[model samples]
Target: MCRLFSLTSRDPVSPMLAINALNVMKEGHDGSGVGLCLRGLGGPFGEMKEAPILSGIFTEAGLKRLSQVSADIGLDPKYSMTFTPKTPPPPGTPKRGTYLARAFDIPDAWKGLAPEELAREYTRFRLMLRTTGEEQGDMQVFSFWPDTLMVKEVGDPMEVAAYLGLDNKDLVARQILAQGRQNTNYAINLYACHPFFIQGVCSMTNGENTAFIPIREYLASRGVDGYCGYQSDSEVFAHILHYTVNRLGLDLEYYKHVITPLTNEELDGHPDRENLVRLKQACRKLVIDGPNCVIGCLPDGSMFMCQDRKKLRPGVVGGKPGVFAFSSEICGLNAAIPDRDTSKDFQPMHLDTAIVRPDCQEVTICSQLQALPHLH
Candidate 1:
């Protein structure tokens, strides 16, 4: 199993805060890898929210190739943050070339496109770079979107953060998600790290995905451009979310229903049963099986957590008014926000999805057995 930690705040916080929280739950996950995704960025990036930021690891050759490709696509470089470790990586950690998070200006030729069209173009550009890097084994792109940055490395979470200079003031953000992987299911490939991102949706999961192959085939058949990579089974969780809410135009609440639908008997007598039945039938292939707990962030900066039908994995949501954290263990929560009201901390059940809006004010628990309240 992996350890998951996510935080959303009204003010920007360092990614190291999330990394430290993951360390408190070190017993749950072996120190095999660390993955982080930061959204609603602050610091230098706050002024460049309109530009798309490409976050990845690159070789010297890969960097040159990336520049050529971006120019070919008419994307102009705006600003960039490149980190080179001051010292060699610690023992057991692989040595890498350069870490980059470069922002690009949307070319004048594509500035008039609609929002959806523009988003599709970003995905295309990212995938093209990914494919080019794959053939040469020189690049590993994690995310390409505005106000977001991602980093994934194979090592202990805390060590990786310090080694990558993640404590830099400019790397702060209002929301961050971190995962400490145990390396139980797949080989230690950097692309298979947690906290996966596509477009504006990002998610990390703990526990095995028993229904991965079927779900992968279903998602791939949708003819989506960014749905090809399946280096990790948990990747489908994020894609399923993108399909349900972004592509299908469904509300965020329906995402839980699509992945862990209530049974026919459980759905009986519910006010929205008709629609729920239709959703369940139509999205049956997307239903997930196995012990898992998922924490995800949407494009709007909202964060959420849900459990499998059996509630096999552990998770908790707790904090004060200005900041909230979703962690795999309560101890992790206490480590991140120690002053929170302990009584208000919530542990979601099989039928519950605990959500904290971008405001970070309160957590709303929506249940599968009842009609969901209108959430905006």
Candidate 2:
């Protein structure tokens, strides 16, 4: 199993808090890798929310490739910033050639497109870069979204943070999702790390995803331009959220229903029984079957955590309005939000979904998908 930590705050905060939390629960994860994704960026990126930011690692050769591709595609970056560790990575740690966070100006031709269309374009561009980088095995692209940065490395969580200069750097954001991966089923591949992102949605998981094959096949069949990568079974969670909201135009709550729909016996008591029955019948392939706990963030800054119907995985959701935490263990939350009222912390059941939005007073628990609330 892996350890997942996330925070949604009204103010800018560093991910060190989350890393510290993960360290306390170190026993739960093997620390094969660490994945971090931040939205509602603060500090240098806070004011550049309107511009698209590209976050990744690039070699000297990779830099030239990026510039050539961007210019060739008419998506030149307006400004770029790179972060390297103040000190070298701990001995034996895997290091990146050059860590970067760049902001790009949307080309005039694409500026007129709708937000969803523009997002798809950016997704295509990111995938193109990934394809190019594969030939060299040096460049690794995490995310290319507006006001968001994603960085992942194969090493101990704390050591990886230091390698990225996470503590000494000016990296800050209103929301962050971090994971310490314990490689149980797969090789130590960087792309297989958690805290996966697609377009504006981000997600990280704490348990195995046994239903990955069917889920991957179902998603690939949809022909979504950005749904091809299956480096991690958990990546599908982020894509599922994107497909539910962007492709189906459904409310976020429906995401819960699609991924963990109620059994026919349970649905018999639902108020929206007819519609839900139709939904389950149509999208049953998307249902995930396994002992899993997932934490995710949406474009609107809403953060959430959910568990499989079996409830085999452990999780805790706590904190007050301005801040709430979703972590794999109580000690993780205590480390992340020591001052918050943890006495009211609750563990979600198979039937519940926990959500927290910026400035929200409390974590909203939705017991049934039909009653799920919307942040907007």
Candidate 3:
């Protein structure tokens, strides 16, 4: 088991707001590591929102290779901010690594393309750097997208936050996703931590994915790029969301349908049953099998939370419209939004998908396979 916390607000807020809440559920996680992704960025990143921000850890030798590769690719880094942790790492913990955040201009060829197309290219570019940098040395790439930054390290959530200067820095964002991983069945790997991102879609989960193999095969077959690393079974959720909205050109609600399709008996009554039947047949490989809760954000900045059909995982989605919070427990939401109506905070039903955005409102996109109460 692990813990996941994410919040989206109209105004830029510190990621510590989410990480602090995640720490409340420390008991559920062994403090193996913390992974975070921030969008709708502000603070030092506020002014550089238009250019893609490259984030990752690099060795001195790896840095030199990065420079050469950037020149070779023709996407020169325009500005960079490197953070060296001031807080000493805890005993038995690995030393803090050199993390770089660089901004680069979109290639001239992609200048007037659709955002989805351009975002795809940005994802591909980041993958190239990750592949190339890995051959150079101890280099790891997280994300490269406009108005986004990601930080991950192996340690306690609070300690990792402090090591990264998350509180002291001028960094802020309207949306942040953080995870405290509890390794099960596999060795501890930083890349396997949650809050995985592909292109503009980012996700963090609280449970495992039994259906990972088929989903991974489906994604790899897409042949669009950025789907190779399966360090974590949960990474497929982000790729599924990416495929649903970005590749399939479907709404976020459809993502819930693809991953948790209803049985034929239930779908027989659905208004969109005909189309859903085709969708289910076409995307059967994506139907996840396991108790899971997913909190994710789209390239457009809209945030969503959904549960698997079994609803085995614990999760709650609540808060005002513009400042929604999704977490594995109420304690987390309490830490971030204590004043909000706890009574109003409700756990999403098995078929319900909650959506929030910069606008102050919450919307539920439920499965059409089931009928609303008192409908007849």
Candidate 4:
């Protein structure tokens, strides 16, 4: 089952534009979104989609297509797009992406635009839809968000993707499964908002994404378990993985989690107990300075919920705290962060990459998908 969740906070440093997104997971994400900040205005607002593969989210139609085409159909897992940015991004980073499409640019000098303006505009103009999970109370759905994120597979290098709404991709997983080694090796893909990329801008035809995958044989060997539900890319699967790694510390194998360096003065002066900004910086550092195929640990050891510094600046005043929820798409997570979905409470989440040693010759990342209470 897939769940939706997000965090909203208030701070003095950032504007109202949608900030960090959840790190992408192995199950992949469909619906997700972020708020726009233009200041001085508040109302439900939305933007026109530039791609048909990413448009027409009027109601259940688009969402339904997402489940069918992206998840069920098992669309071919492939990658062909490579971006040569007009300018180099931050530096050595993989958590960011090329600007595939412009989601409406804002002037860097807009002090009038508050964060709430973006939240209000999205709520007022956009139609809210979530992915309903069969999992009992509270874990009912993941808010739908249109996304076209692409990831580069270093292991095999396939362009992995996730989408919300109908797209006739029922054969997606099956297509992936078909390519598998006799179904014994199951392929797992993930999507969230934790990006450490160093190039590309937020422009039209430059939407960003992160992709990852692990084989089924490895998961089964570790006694890790998961169920592939319709349109369920492995949201629950991710949650389960989190439990194994963070709570169980299974990552000690070939992968190691190191607490980043922090200053006493900066740490002492900050008020947001979570210190999300520092956490994201560390995750980005993982991709930049760590090893090949780095693992960027998120705010919460388990889920990739809220946006992090790898993607954008820290967030608003008490928007939401905790590493319980993360979104594949900013809008999807934001839409569900404050609403009711059976029983799950929406919240922000953390992120991390499961860096495996090329010499290990095995897979070993344990985690799970989370729930939401969204509707913001």
Candidate 5:
């Protein structure tokens, strides 16, 4: 399915490291792209971004039409705000459109059901999009890659197709990353994240759950220690996580938390499959005392210019530039952190900086993953 995944180990990858990786994959998939905005800009928590083309997606004319149609059912002023859709750019325009509800602040009951939530929100977003998602045309939100990893160095399309065993490159647009293994048996086409269009009723893609509810149930029942979620940006992620944790009455220091990918099936449902309750339980015990984790992820190369803009200072790896990258690569990192040049020849950084990072950043999802080879 959606192939993005991260591997964490106290000896290697930690929770902070996982968050950084997840941040890289999700840096670009923000509320601005979706046309959502929060009322208050400076709340303690992160504010939502207004989708770039809010006015265009929901036009005055379209709102009028919706009003008239809704008047028949008294769904007027009560939901008038729902009528004003974010505007959509006309055809042939570089800028695409956003969903109307995305920009509007409404009850979770009023928004689109987010089916894509888990380790690889990006990959799941693509997968859900392909199954039942839709977005602004300009954004090409549904264009998944034949292989997400091949994007590491910007290789030719043909080269990517060759590595992913893609017979019909034309059929795939969004990136879908997966590692090449000698005995790979993963059912790679079952990604739960997919593009979705919001409607009056909150719904999700490919018959998945409304939001990450299914994933939550999966994790809670399995006793996993990590949390899986999606937002417009890292700040929004921070906000949501901050609020949710407070709601649960748990402080940030209860233990180390590792975020990771829950399989696509887990996001929606693994029909005919048993839950991974025991594995999740083990995860909780491990993280309740520690915060290390392996988060699922994929790099958004589009931010090649804004790499380190959101990276936390006093980085986890000290001065290893790309270790806690905002985006995926150093060139991408260069865009975010213009001061540091990863290209500079050996500036005397940690040896791990040169960890032969592969194009497919996907590593052993964790030896722990192997422990539950049959999690489903």
Candidate 6:
């Protein structure tokens, strides 16, 4: 199992805090890789929230190609932060080229486009860069979205964090999702790292996805450009989320129903039973059969965690009024927010979904058994 750590605070914090939390649960995950997703950015990025930021690594040649592509696509460079490792990478960690998170102005032609249309353009642009990099073997793009940044590398969590200079104040964000990968199901590919992102949705899981292929096929058939990559089985979780809330125009709570639907007996006499039944039938292919615990963040900085119907994996959510963490282990929560009241900490079970909105003030535990307010 991989160790997952996610934190959202009213104020921006360094990624090191999440990395340190992952270190506390080090025993659960092999030192194979680490993946981080930081949103609700602060510092320099805080002011540039309107610009889409591209996060990834690039070689010298790749960097030139990226610039050329940006010009061809009409995206103007606004700002950039590049890291050239100050010291040699630790053992088992491959030497990489420049690590970057650069923000770009939307093309003038796209300025008048609708929000959804612009989002589609961003997805297409990011995929083009990813494909170019993959074919040329020079670039590896993780995310290209506003107010979001992703970093993934192969090595121990702490070591990778240091090598990438993640402690820098400029990299601070109000919300962060970090995973200590175990690499039990697949090889250590950077794209396979956890905390997968598409458009504005991001998610990471702590257990094997037994229903990956069916879910992947269903998502790919939707003809969505951003749903094509399935390097990691867990990537489907994020796509499923995007499809549920963005594509279908459903409420956020519907995502839980789509992924882990209740049986007819369980839904019997429920307030939305008829709608639930139709939803279950229509989205059956998207249902996940898991021993999985999924933690994710939406476009609005809302953080959530849900367990499989069987509750086969462990997860906990706890913190103070201004900050909260969703972790695979309580020790991780302790490490990230020690002063919180342990008595209020929640361990969501099979039918529960723990959510923390952008304010980061409190955790709302919504059950499948209860009718939840519609959330976009």
**lDDT value for model 6:** 0.90
Tens digits of per-residue lDDT for model 5, 1-376: 1111222111212222322332343432221111111111121111322211121223344445434533443322311111211333322222322323222232233245453222233234333333332232221222222111111101222232233232322212111221111111222111112211111000011111122333354434533222233321121122222222332333221111222223444434533123334333434322111111111121221110000111221111111323323222333334323454354322111111111122323111122122222211
Residue 240 accuracy (lDDT) in model 3: 90
lDDT (Cα, tens digit) per residue for candidate 1, span 1-376: 7899999999999998999998999999888889999999998889999899999999999999899989988889999998789988976688988999999998887799998888989898888888889899889898899999999898888888888898998889988999997355777778799898988999989978989999999999999989988898999999999998888788778889999998889888988888889889999999999699999999999999999997889999999999999999999999999999999999999999999998899998988886864433
Model 3 bad stretches (over 4 Å):
112-117, 363-365, 370-376
Task: Output the worst ten-in-a-row residue range by lDDT, candidate 1.
Answer: 367-376
Give Cα-based local distance difference scores for all models: 0.90, 0.84, 0.82, 0.23, 0.23, 0.90
Model 1 residue 349 lDDT? 97
For candidate 2, what is the lDDT? 0.84
- Could you tell me every candidate's TM-score relative to the true structure? 0.98, 0.95, 0.93, 0.21, 0.26, 0.98
What's the CA error at residue 107 for candidate 2, in Å?
1.4
Tens-digit lDDT track for model 2 on 1-376? 7899999888888889888988999999887778889999888778778888988889989988888888877787877778777676775466568888898887888989998789889988888888778778858888889989888887789887777778745688889899987455776666778888988888888777889999999999998888986877888999999988878777767888989998888888778887788878988999998788989999989999988888999999998778888999999998888888767898989988888866657887787645444423
Residues 191-275, model 4: lDDT tens digits: 1221211000010001111211232223334432221221221222233333334434443221222222223443454443243
Pairs that collide, model 2: 321-360, 321-361
Better of 1 and 4 by lDDT: 1
Residue 148 lDDT, candidate 3, scale 0-100? 86
Query: Residue 350 CA error for candidate 2 (Å)?
Result: 0.4
Worst 10 residues of 3 by lDDT: 367-376
The list of candidate 4 runs beyond 4 A from truth reads 1-58, 61-215, 220-376
